[model samples]
Target: MPSQTKRKKPYSHFRLRKFLFFTVPFTILALFLLRTSSSSSSTASVSSSYTTYQPPWFGDLQTAQFPWNRLAFSLTNPPPKTLKLAVFSRKWPTGPNPGGMERHAFTLYTALARRGHRVHVFTSSLDPFLKTDKIINLKIHPHGDAESGKWRYNKAWELYQEENQKQPFDVIHSESVALPYWKAREVPNLAVTWHGIALESLHSSIYQDLIRKPGEPRLQSFNASLYSAVLPKILDEIRFFNNYAHHIAISDSCGEMLRDVYQIPEKRVHVIFNGVDENGFTSDKKLRSLFRSKLGIQENSSAIVLGAAGRLVKDKGHPLLFEAFEKLIETHSNVHLVVAGSGPWEQRYKKLGDQVTVLGSLNPNELKGFYNGIDIFVNPTLRPQGLDLTLMEAMLSGKPVMASRYPSIKRSVVVNDEFGFMFAPNVEALTTVMEVAVAEGAERLAERGRKCKEYAAEMFTASKMALAYEKLFLCIKDERFCIYP
Candidate 1:
C-alpha cells in the first residue's frame, strides 16, 4: 500500500508538469491574438474618425470672433507696422526653376515685403541677368561666386553683420541650416525653419528599407548602421539643435518631434505650415480645358487625367508609382498619367507611350498650367520628412491629391479624408488607391477638389503663413505683443 501511494504521487507530479507545458503556451497564444484583434479595431476606429476630423486651426479660421482670425484680417486690411527683416537663405530663387526651399524663401519674404516690411535677403550670388529687388521694400545681398553656384555661409554671415551694424534687424529668419549653429547661437532674435531633420532622415531610411524589393539595391542600408551610425548622428543633431534660439517646424508632426524627441522647450518651438501662391494656382475652368486639350485629352472622352510633379527620383517613390501605374493602365484603358519634372525615370515614363505624357521639368507658369489640367494629383513620396510644397500647390489649384499615408501629409495636408486619398508606401496600396480614384470618375473628383480648394484657401495661402510668421516675429521682438488677442 505504501509503494502504491508513492507511485501515485510521482504520477500526479508528472501530469501537473505536462499540463503547465501545454497550457502556458496556449494561454500566451490566446492573449497575443486578442491583443492583435484589439489593435486592428483601434486602427479602424481612428481611420473612421479621420473622415469627420477638421483641423482645429481650420475651425479657428472659420470663427469670426477668433483672435487669430481677427489678426489675419487685420494684417491684410491696413497691414501691420513695418518691420526690418533679415533673411539668411543659402540660395534665393533666381528663375522659374528654383528648388522648394528657395521657392519658399522667395514667396515668404516677398509677401512680407509686400505688406510694407523692409526685408533684406543674404544669399548666394545670382545670375547677372536675373532681376531682383523689384519689390519696393525688398533687397537682395548676394555673397558668393555665381559661376560655381557654391554658397559661402561665412561670406553671407559677414554681409549680414555689416548690414546689422547699420540698422538692427527686427527679426532674423534662417532657411534650414543656412546660418551655421555657431553663428545662430549668438543671434537672440533668430528663428530657423527646419525643412528636414536628422531624426526624420533616420525614419525615412527605415521606411525605405521596409518597402524595398527582394532584389532591389539598398541605398539606405538601414539595418547595417542603425545603431552604429544613424542613432549617434541623431543624438548629435538633438544636441546641436539647442544652439538655436527658436525653431520653426513646417509640419505638425515635425513640431511634435521638435518638442518631444529633440527635447526642445515648448515655448521655443513653433509650427507654421508652408503656404502656396493662391492667386497663381487657382481653379480656372477655361485654363483647365485649354491645358487638357493641349495634352490631347478630349473633354468629352471618359478619360481621367492624373498628374504627378517633382523630381522623379527613387525617394519620390517613382518606382512604386511606375509599377502601380503600369498595372493600372493594363486594367483601365481610360486612365492617363501626366508627369511633370524630370530625372532618371523620365525615359522610363516616356516608354509608356501615348497613355503617359512626360512633360519633363517645367517652368513656374507651365507648372501652374499642369495643375489646372489634371483631375487628380498623385504624390507617392517614400521619404517622410517635410511637407511638400507641391501638395499645397495642388490643393490651391483645386485638385484633390492621392498621397502617401505618412504622418506629415496625413496630419497637415490631408487632415480630412474628404480632401484626398492616402495609401501605404507600397505598389499594391498605391495601385488600389489609383483604381478607387478611377472608379470615382472625374466629376466626383471635381467635387473633392472644390472642398480641397476651399480648405486650402483659408489655410495655405502665402498671406496666412506670412501673417503667422509676422505675429511670431512681433512676439519675439516684444513679449507684450505675445498675447493671443
Candidate 2:
C-alpha cells in the first residue's frame, strides 16, 4: 500500500509541472496571433477602399486620341446653324460652396437653354450641389475619386472626349484651364475663361504675409513646387484664350488682367459682366419683416442688420470688417450684424457674437430674404473676386452697397453717396465709409437703394450675359480674327 501511494504522488507532480510550463504559454501565444491578424485585416480593408472606383472617364476610357495638331472632326453629319453648345466645369453652383465661376456658368447655361439651345453640363458628382429626382435636363455623370470612390471632373472630361469622337458640338465651353478636350488640332472652337489666375490671387498683401511666418517651412518648400511647375504650363495655353471663339470677362478689369498678363488682344477679350436672376430677388416688406422676426430682431427696435457672405478667409476681409463693426457699436445703438457663410476663421469672429448674428449658410431664397431685411449690404473683399454674385443679389434686393474698391469692384460697381459707397480694402478706409453711410439715415438710404436696383437692371441681368456669350460663340465659329487685337 505504501509503494502504490508513492507511485501516484509522482504522477500527480508530473501533471502539475506540464500545466505550469506549457498551457499558460500556449494561451498567451494564441492571443498575440489573434491580435496581429485583426490589425492586418483592418489595414488591408483600408488600402483596398481607395483604389476600387473607376468613373466613366479616368483610366482606360480615352474618348478622342487625336494628336495635338489635328483638332477638327470629320463631318459625318451637317452641323446645326445655332450650334449644339456644351459647357464643362470642375464644379457647379451649390450654396456657400458655389463661387462666382460656378454661378456664372449655370446662369449662362440656363439662359442658353431658355433660348432654344440644348446645353449639357458634365459634372463629377452633385453630392453637395443640389438634390433632385430629375437630373435628365443636366446630363450629370458621377465619377468617384481614385481612393474615395468619387467621380472627378477632369476624369469625366477625358471620358467624354474619348466617347464622343465626332465632335458632336460646334464649340465646347471649358471653365477650368485644366480639362481634357478632343481634337487637339481643330480644337473645336473651345471657349475657355479663367475665373482668375492664382499667380495674381496669391500676390495679395495679406496672403503673402501669412505664408511667410517664422519657424514655418517656406510656402515655396510646401506647395510652391506644384504651382511653380503647373501654372506656367497653364498660362502658356493663354495664346489660345484670345484666339478661341469668344473670350468673356466678368468685368472690364478681368478683361484687362487677361490682356496685360497674357498679351491677349483686346479684340478677342470682350467684357461680359456676370449677371444674377433679378426676378428671383424681388422682395416685399411683409417678407422682410417675416425673415427679421425669425432672426430674433424686435420689430420696434431701430435694429440695423449688416450682413456679408463669403468664405471666412482673411482675403474676404472679415477681420477688417469685424474691427470696423466693433468701432461702429461705440456710437450706434441697436445695430446688429448677420453673417452667413463658413470658412477657416469661423471662430475668430465669435467676440462679436452678441452684437452679430452668425447664420452659417443660407439657400438662395433665404439669402434673398436676408438681403431684403438688412439695412445695407457690405462686401469687404481683400482679394480680387470676379463679379460677386452675392453683391449683385444684394444690389437687386434693393439695398445700398458699401463695397471694397478693389480694382475689380471699382470697374464693376458705381459708387455715389446717394447709391452706395466704395472704400479702399483696409480697416481704416472701410470703417470711415461705413460710419458715414450708417449715419446718413433712412431717406438717403432709400434713394441709394433705388439707384442700386437700377444699376443691377441696367447691367447685371442673366439675359445680357447670355447674349454676350452667344455672340462670342458665333465669333469663334466664324473664325473672326485669328490673332489677338
Candidate 3:
C-alpha cells in the first residue's frame, strides 16, 4: 500500500493553545465593548435623572387670595413710597420699520418718562428709532448666520437676567413676546401688553416666522412652508408663552384666542386695544392735494381712489386688492388704487399690471397726506386681525374703510357698513364689495368716515389708551408698594 503514516491523536493542550489564539482577542474585544456600553448607559441615566428648575418670571398674582389678588388702585392718591418700572421689547423702531410698534414704543417711553416714572426699555438694536433712559440692546448675529448668531441672542438674554439682578423693578411691562414669562418671578408685578395674537393656523405660522427671522422672505412664506414647518413650532410656542405670564390681550379676539388656545383662566387675561395719535392724522385739504399731486393723481378724476397702506405682504391682500381694483376699474372708470408701504412682494404685486399706484413708503407726516389723497381706505389683511394703526389713522382721517371681517378687526375696529365694509377674505367677495363701495360714492362714504372719526376721537385716541394703561399700571404698582409699605 502507499505507506500511510499514523496520524497523532489531538491533545487537550494543543486544542487549548488554538482556542487561546482565536478566543483571547475576541474576549478582550467583548469585554471592551461591554465596558464601553456600560459607561454610555451610566452617562445616559445620569443625564435623564438631572433636571433644572426655572422659576416663572411672574409670581402667582392672579392666584393670590383676597385683597392681595385684587389690583390695588391710586386715584388722586400719593405717589408710591418706592417706584420702579421695567419695560421689555425685542426691537426698537430705529431704521426701517413702517413706524407702527416702534412709534408706539417711543411714544410709550417718552410719555412714561415725562410722567417721571423710571422706565427702562430692554430690547434689541434692530429697532432704528429707539432711544430711552435705560435700554438693553441684546447683541445678535446678523441674519442667516444661525450658528454664531444664536449665541448672541442667548448671551443677550443672559445679560438681561444678570443686569436685572442689580436692581429689581417693582413692575414689569413688556411689549414683546415672552419677556413676562422669563422676568415674571424676578419682578414683583408684571403686565404684558400684546400687540397681536396668533389665532388661526396662518397667524400661528406668521408669529413663528417673526420669532425665527425678524424680517424678509421668511415672514412671507405661505401655505407650503407655513403648514409644513411653521405651524407645529408656533403651536408649541403659543402654548408656552400663554402659560408663562399674566397675559394681556390687545383685542377682544386675542383674549378669546388665549382662552381657546391655552385654557388660560378667565381672570388672567384682559383686552386693551391699541390707540393712535388722533391729532397727527387729521384731514386737511391742502395736505391732501399736495400728496395727490405728488402721486400724479388728478383731484378732479371721477375715479374712486382707493388706498391700501402697510407692508405689501401676501397676507395683507395686496394681490387681492389688485384683483378687486382690476374688476372695479371695469365698472368705475375713475377708480385708482394707491398702495403705501413696502415688503418682499412689492414688485410681484406691482407686476400684476394694474393701474394701481405704489407709493412705496411714507413718513408719519406724509402718511396723513396719503390718507387724505384717497377717497376710501381699505385694510384687506388676511387672517387673525387686531387693530392696525393704519386703520385707526384711516378712521381718524374721516375716510371710509373696507376691512377683512376677521374676528379681531370686526371686534376691535370694524363697526359696520357704517364705519367700513366687512367683506369676505377671498377675491370674488372682496371685489364685489369694492364695487359696492365704489358705487357708494364720496359724499355717502365721507359721512360714514366722519362717523368713524367721531368714534375714533371718543374711543380709540392715544390719550384714552394711555390713560387706561396709566391707571392699570398705577393700580398694580400701588398694590405691590402697599405690601412693603
Best by TM-score: 1
Q: Residues 362-473, candidate 2, lDDT per residue (tens digit)?
A: 8777787888888788888776756678788888888888887655665455533455888876677878987787777655776788778876765666765666566556
Q: What is residue 349's positional error in candidate 3, in angstroms?
A: 5.1
Give per-model TM-scores: 0.85, 0.71, 0.70
lDDT of 3 by residue, 1-485 (tens): 87699766779779889999999999997985566355433322221111112222234333321112112233244344334566666555555453566667666555555455666655554422344344332222122223321223343445556656977665677774536355454444677776765445465345334323224465344666766765765576566665444566666556656665557776566555567777888878898788777766787755677898988776677666767777777766667788888887677656645567787878787788888888889887765655688888888888878987765666556644477788876677888888888887877877888888876765566655654456556656664522321
* TM-score of predicted structure 2: 0.71
Tens digit per residue, CA lDDT, model 1, 1-485: 45654346658988999999999999987985566455434332332233444233333211111113113445436444678999999888877678889988988989888888899999888888877658888999989655534689899888998999999999999999999898999999999999998888886776677777789877655556887788898898899899899888887667767876799887888777778888889888788889989988887978999999999998898988999999999989999999999899999998887899999988878888899999999999888899898998999999999999876777667867789899998999999999999999999999999888987887688888888788778877777656655
Q: What is the Cα-based lDDT of residue 435 in candidate 2?
A: 78
Runs of candidate 2 exceeding 4 Å displacement: 1-81, 93-97, 128-130, 133-138, 141-154, 178-188, 202-245, 295-300, 415-417, 479-485
Residue 184, model 2: Cα distance from true site in angstroms? 6.5
Candidate 1 residue runs with Cα over 4 Å from true position: 1-73, 145-148, 217-229
Better of 1 and 2 by TM-score: 1
Off by over 4 Å in 3: 1-83, 96-99, 126-167, 178-188, 201-231, 234-239, 296-301, 348-354, 480-485
The lDDT values for all models are 0.81, 0.63, 0.62
The positional error of residue 54 in candidate 1, measured at the CA in angstroms, is: 8.4
> How many clashes in each candidate?
0, 21, 13
